[model samples]
Target: MRRTARRAGKALGAGAAAALLALATPAGTAQAADGVLSIDGTEHEDPSGCFPLGDFAPPKIANLTDGTAWIWSGPSCDGQVTQQIDPGTSAIGRGRSLYIE
Candidate 1:
């Protein structure tokens, strides 16, 4: 009985650690082909074309597509284009425009 109780306690501890890790990890918008675009903190998932981002540039963004994505500094797929971001990668200074092709 005592050994059983100890094993249960260890299992609980492991479960708690896994939960903590999941919470600490940044979550991506799963399986989005076009990825999720954040313009001035607003998230846009999937589809294409200019969506009128106004003047607010995105300070950070994430690539939630199945493949890789490119983030640009300016609108209309122009300006400082970032390197290919794999799925689920996120960071700051990703600029305003995002295109996944």
Candidate 2:
């Protein structure tokens, strides 16, 4: 009975650790910025994931949200990253996509 109790305690500890790690790790689209991402002066509120910028890629961008924004050269944010705009920051770079994280 004592050994069984010990095993149960170990399992509980491990499970707790796993749960903590999961909480600490970033879940896809789970958390989002509480602000907006401005593209060419247009604000996109509560943006999540990748925002594609088709042929008319905006040259000026402003990250007014509390998240990091990545400017990608290719559509769907698959290619090179043109700029990294942080929270409350702005940049002058043209890109085909914008990823807010």
Candidate 3:
């Protein structure tokens, strides 16, 4: 009886750990609103290409200048690439680039 109880306790502990891990994992969705970006409930800004860009339901650009522009590449949380509009400068939008790099 004691051995059975010990085994049951161990199993319960393992199950609890697994549950915790599942809860800790990030969600597969992202949220964007009012020009703000978020991923798995975490606020993010100027995220790198590796970060999920979330649903591309719509494209919005912020902080535009004569030589810079931002573009949304897709309709899903794939990734975004930034391109330079000028031949030698990192600025974008001057060359009328259709998409990000």
Give the number of the best model, judged by lDDT.
2
What's the true lDDT of residue 97 in model 1? 58
| Model 3 Cα lDDT, one tens digit per residue, 13-80 | 99999999999999775332222233333433433332333443322223222222233343332235
Which stretch of 10 consecutive residues in model 1 shows the poorest summed lDDT? 49-58
RMSD of each: 13.3, 5.6, 10.7
User: 10-96 in candidate 1: lDDT tens per residue?
Assistant: 999999999999999889754446667654467777745443333554456565656566766677767877545577877664456
For candidate 1, the per-residue lDDT at 23 reads 98
Order the candidates by TM-score, highest first — what do you get? 2, 1, 3
Pick the winner on lDDT between candidates 1 and 2: 2
Error of 2 at 32 (Å): 1.3
Predicted structure 3, TM vs. truth: 0.33
CA lDDT of each candidate? 0.64, 0.84, 0.38
TM-scores vs. true structure, each candidate? 0.43, 0.64, 0.33
Weakest ten-residue segment in model 3 by summed lDDT: 92-101
| Total clashing pairs in model 1 | 0
Candidate 1: which pairs clash?
A: none
Model 2, stretches more than 4 Å misplaced? 1-29
